[model samples]
Each structure stands twice: as C-alpha cells, then as structure tokens.
Target: MNYSRRHLLQGSLAAGGSLAAFGDQHLAEELERKLRGRRPLGIVFCVSDGMSQGVLSMSEAFSQQVRSQGTVWWNLMSSQKAVMGLMDTASSSSLVTDSAAASSAWSGGQRIPNGKINVDEQGREIESLGETLEKSHLRLGLVSSATITHATPAAFAATVPNRGQEESIAEQYLNRVDVLLGGGSRFFDPKVRKDHQNLFEIFEKQNYQVIRTRNELLHSKSEKLLGTFSPGYLPYELDRKHDEELMKKIPSLAEMTEAALSRFLSSGDPFLMQMEGARIDHAAHQNDIGAILHEQLAFDDAVAKVLTLTAHREDILVILTSDHGNANPGLNGTGSSYRETNRSFSKVAEITRSTENFLSQCQQELRHSKLDLAEFFTSTYGFAPSANELDALMERLSGREVVEWSQQHKNSVGLLGQIVGNVTGVGWTGICHTADPTQLTSTGPGANQFAGLIRNDSVRDRLLRLLPI
Candidate 1:
C-alpha cells in the first residue's frame, strides 16, 4: 500500500473518532491492533560515526554539565519504548573496520574490506540500499557533517572499489539521492573539481535546488535539494560554536537533519534518510576529548530533533547507531578515592577550540613571528602545559621522533591530547578505529528487528523487510 498524508491522517482520525464516539473497550482494542499492523511510511537512520561506548557516556555527562539535562540518547535507552542493541561492526579483511566497510556492511548487506564501499573482497559490485530504494521509486536522502561524498554517506548510494574515489561517488548521487545536504562543495564546483564538471549546474538542470549557505537552506522551498556548506567537511562543532561568523554561514547537524527529513515527511513519500555527525570520528582520531564530546552532543541534538519531528506520526521508523569505535576515550579516576573525577572532567568545558584549529593557529604564528607555545596553549586550553610537555609537543610538530609506545600516538595531535588529558582525567587508547561493537537503538515500526546483538550485515535485510517493494 502506498502510504500518503491523506490516507494516514484519515485512518488515524477515523479510528480515533470511532473509539471516542463508541467508548467501547473492544472497539479501542481493535483500533490498536490495526494501528500496530500498519507499516511505516518512512525511515530515518542516524549515525554518530566512530562513537564508542565511552563517548556515549561522556556525552551524557557533558550534556548534564552544560545543559542541566540528560541527553536524548541516554533517555531513550532508559525508556521502555525504544529497543536497544549492540551492532557487531567488522569487515572482511580485519576485526577492525573503517567507516567505508562498516557502513557498507549495513548498506550493501556484506562485510567487505576495510576501505571498500559496496565492493566485495573479489571486487564484485553489490547493490547499495539507495540504489535498491531508487528502483522501487522510493526516495533516499543523505545528510552528513563530513564531505557529502565521504565514506559513510557514500556507502549508502554509490559503489566504488576504493573509498578514496570521492569524485566518482559525488557523481553517482546525482539521480539516486533526492535530498543531499552537507559539505564538499568543491566536488560540485567546476572551478575546483579535477574533472571541471559543473555538478551544481547538472543537478540544477535535473531539478535539484543547489544551495551553498545556511540562509539559502533555511529558505529553500524545493523538495529536491543539494546543499553544500563547505569545501570539505564542515567545521567541527566545537570550532563552529566559538566562531560567530562561521555559525551564521553553516547549519548545525540538527538543522541539516530537519531540512532533509521535513521535505520527505511533507511529501508523504516512503523514504530512507541517513543523517550523520561525521566530526566525532575525526575528533576521536585526533584524540581530542573536548571536540569529541561536543560532536557527540551535536549528534544527540539531531537525535532529539528526529524524535520530535516523528513523535505524532506512527509511519516513521528511526534507528540510531555508530559505525565503529575510535580511541575509546574515558574519564579516569583522579585524586584520593576518585573525588577529583568530576572536577577533572569539568576542565573540558574550558577548551575554546579544536586541536586542529589550535595547530593551524600555531603554524601561522610560528611562521610569521615569535609564538610562545606555552602561552598559546594556556590561552586556548585554559591551562599551562609543563615545560617537558610543551617541549615534546613542539618536537612532534617539527617532525622529530617522540618515544611513544603506540605508533598511532606519536603525532603532534596525540601528544597534545595526552597533555590535555592529564588535566581532564580522560585517557585514549591510541588514535585509530577499535574492534568493538557499537551501541544501537530504534523506535517505531519494525524496531524489534534490531534488538539484541545484531551483525552489521543484517541491517539491509531488516530495513528491506520493513519497506516492502
């Protein structure tokens, strides 16, 4: 049955009115049964890329500290209405998985290599969920904080042997995806693209409203939209929050989520939309505690928006999960009997910028004039680094070898993270993807299919069952 706004509203009003008029218990029970039997008209899948168990816990704590409230995700897990599960995230080549294979497991229904998207180990092409949905005349939408052609989003709609082939992935989304909102404007701009192909013009010719600014996105009336806010991945939530001008130019993850989802909901189309908070993974890779927590919170805000928009509708299913774990950042016990734990964790709130922004400033300062590294660190992080820690950071930035046990932690960002972690009580297990199952939760119709420990490869089939073609 093709579910439309009229059909759904009429069914609901009729059932509700009849029950209210008759006031018979049997009539109410029959109405409930029929409502439960109806299939969903849409599905929204939210991804907090590279979020670990610790990230979720820290985000909850951070939200409580700043907003004086628990996070939406934490509340969802506490509630009885949502079904919770753990996703077994792995790849064909290794126990650890990158964004490409992890998402491919869900989109293509196969555990390919760590860096391939919808391509099997033998290089065979697998049909992606977006492609399959397109064939059924169902719409697909992708909203991400990463470049729109990044691994996680690309796995859903585009097939390529290597995840690095982003230009090709951008091309593939032309007709397959109905709503595309994120970063990576360079891939669409003819002047910046290597191929000099004007993707914006092409998409506009195909009836897509190409937008580049936050204002345009907010005012856009077109149902078919392609909005790119940055040349690459959008600025990290931590960085964007502190910059006044950048805040006006770029939309929040929640805003993008709303823009994509509202269009689908109003159109009354049976659709699949994927919303991603992509910066959490980048922050985790850098072992930046402040950035990671802020990114996770941004993702949580998007989750809250999703639940609110679908609250009254019984025809939308929402699933939230992470692709893989990275750096596994956790707050460690500090001081006698761990009494200092909260105070130590509180230091994260003082961080004014991401490590990436800090490093960029350091580079500019060092090149142009004398920069007191110690003073710079104190100003940005709200704490002065010790002489030895400052020396190590400077050496690492200069490409000098730092005697770090883990090869992944030998970089300048990792060194800075460790120095900051000393005060924040947070510790990271290197800077790379971990072999861990990710948290999963779902609500609305067919949510039970995600309960318990589910493998990533089973996601496509579960979604397909709910969305009959």
Candidate 2:
C-alpha cells in the first residue's frame, strides 16, 4: 500500500502491541475463544449506513466543523489510521444491498438476503451479537439518529420480518437492554400507529424509564431508560446547530453515545454499544448536501464520546465504518479532472442549514436561468443579495416558463448535486450507491483482527472471536 494508507492503518492501530497474539487470521477463532471469560472486552461498533465514500472523505476533510475542544475522538480519528478494507457489498439477491443485509454482514457475521436481519428464509433464528454479549457479562445499548428500529441498530438486538415491523420491534426491547436512545417515538406511542402496542407502557412496566425529552433522558433514575426523542429521524445537524436551546433539548448522536457509555459502564463490566450516524443515509437518499454534512458532524461527536472513555482502556475495541456508499457527493471541479473547484470543508456547520434547506427547495431553475440562487438564499437566510444578481433573477423569471424535475428521479447525487449545485455550484454524479468497499478503522483490545483488508462480516466475527460468548 502507499504511504498515506499505511499512515492511516498504523495511526489507527497504535495499540497493536496489546493484540499481537491475534495477528494470525487463521488463529483468530482460537484467540477469540481464549477471550471468552478472561478480558473485559468492550465493543463500540459504529455503522454509517448509506454513508457514501464522498461523505466518508468529506467528514474527515471537515472534521472541525462541529468539533468541540478536548474531544479525544477527534485526535483518535485524525492520526489513528484504521485498517481500510473494501468489502463486496452485494446481498443474496441484488447488486444493491439494503440496510438489513448490509447490517447483517456485521451483526450476524454472515451475510443474509436483503430485508432479512440475521434470519434464514424459513424465519429460523440466529444468535445476534447482542445476545452473545448478554450471554456473557457485558451490558447492551443501541443508539442512532434514525428510529431505534432502523436496520443497523436493530440488527444486534432484535429480529423481524419486514424492516418496517418497528411497532413489533419496540415490544421486544421489554427485555434485557439497558439503554435505547434515538428517534422513533412514533413506534413507542401507540397513538402514532394503530399497532404500535403502546410499548412505552411495556418499557415502563419492565422498569425501563421511558424518557421523552432530553432532560428526562439525562436524569432518568431507572437503570433501563428508553429515550425516543423524535417520532422520525431527528432534525438535520445544520438546523439543530442553529438553535442553542434546541440543540440541548434533543441529544445529538454524540450525546446519546456519551449517555450510553455512562449507563453501560455502570454495570461494572465493560459493555457493547453501537453508534449510528443515520442521517448520512437520509441526506444521501434526498441528495441533500447540507443534511449529509451536518449529521456527519453530529456523528463525529459520538466518535469523540467513545474516544474519551476508551483513551485510558487498553483493551476496548472501537471500530468505525460505513455500510455502503450513496449519492456519491464531491466538491465541484474545473479544468482537467475538475480539480480546481474543490472546496475546503473546514467545518460543515460553517454552512448554515437554512441555506441547505432552501437549496433543496429550488435549485434546477437557478441553473437553467443562470440565476445564482445563492443570492436569493442569502437574502432569504439573512445575507444581502447583490443588485446585479437580483436583476439577473428578475430578468430570467420575467417571461420564461419554468420546468420542474419529476419525483421519480432516482439518482440521489443527481438530485443533491442539482440542489447543492445551484446553491454552491458544486459538481457530482447522479444519486446512486457505489459498490465500493468501505474503510474499516479499529482501536483497543481485539483490534489486531482489523488489520489490513477484510470482509465486512469479518468485523463481527472478529468481535465474536474477541468476546467468546
């Protein structure tokens, strides 16, 4: 490999000395069994579902946007190079893998068909990583920016037919889980759906303090607290960051990660947690550049959370990665490969969310009319518009009829590029998932299993090998 990649792998594996015993992949299984009852194995697995290669690269390029001072996650991600691998993201049926199958590659340690979570076609059950950890002494927790029942987080703890069977999924949490945080209040509130089963009651009956607000999530006395902050996915980080009081009310992905760590750590035994930057997927689906960037910033905070707690633990294994690439966004280019227009992403939050929201609403017309919507957006979002630009817009719209794109437009980056393009004039491909292998970075105990290139399922197998249920 080249020097840049080598630096990334070495920096991420700085604690390689502790995991030297598992260097032999052939011996990985035996090493995992040896860890079954000995070490305090802590696994913090992150799934950046639908996280495009573009988003992955962009987040690193602009890590400081939502970065806070004293965040160890930043330091850990910056110099720590992860063992980067490209896994074939194909499912049993299609070239494009859905969230369930993508997640199963890691959760079940065996790839399943799309729409299934660790289950065979006959519905026979398979042991999940969460069940294995619970079989051991570790605590269990699941958090995400999307609904808790979302495929990635649910893969570890729950199983069901339709990934949309969230109503039923909420009921399953009535068992041994300690912390469940994220959006999906709709799944808990029976009123939101006829069959939601009013799971808030079940969680309460089981002694799980159902927390609805941020304060409740922070202060709940019950060891098992279920915090469902939003009915759907939480607001974009760009929008949330604009409001200080609003930002504090709903826990960011990082805050949820911190809460999960604190609550799980109380078990006196190292636990397992999964942190997801779900919006990166949503933004990709909508091709919303602003949403994708800000949520990524929010996710970086969660990375910081784990880094803080594990910086001292030489045995904890922290893995970072995305499932698949979506709407591959990139900075606009110019002559020869369009390299000149590349934008510097110091911090994604540096761009206001209103700008993002407005861009999504009206971009195509701006392109055809040569009317930089950025000016209209500037005035609408509180910046001033130039007289020349205002005249250009008026002249363009004066007598010309407008054409609208159809909803069937499937290319995500195309949609996103059109919107963000008109706003910022950045160029990118149409919205679509790239079959590229994702980057995998790891630290702490059992990390040797993450060296070099490996399959996505190899990640879970490595964790299972490390914990030895």
Per-model TM values vs. the true structure:
0.92, 0.78
Best by TM-score: 1
TM-score computed on alpha carbons, candidate 2: 0.78
List model 2 lDDT by residue over 1-469, tens digit each. Answer: 4432333233334424245533455444443344433344577887777776677666665554444343233355566544444555766666777788778777777777788877856777767777766767567789998898888888887777677788766776666467899999998897887764778887788888888788877677777779998898777777787778767788778878888887666565667788888888777766666677667767877887777877776666788878877767776544466443433233233456643455554555555766556565564433444555444434433543223254333332343245445444344454556566766677766565666666666556556555524
Flag regions of model 1 displaced more than 4 Å. Answer: 1-38
Per-residue lDDT of 5-60 in model 1, one digit per residue for the tens?
Answer: 33433344432344353445565456445554756789999999999999999989
> Candidate 2: lDDT over CA atoms?
0.66
Model 1 worst lDDT window (10 residues):
1-10
Model 2: lDDT of residue 231: 93
In order, the Cα lDDT scores of the candidates are 0.90, 0.66
**lDDT at residue 391 of model 2 (Cα atoms):** 46
Model 2 sits at a Cα RMSD from the real structure of 7.8
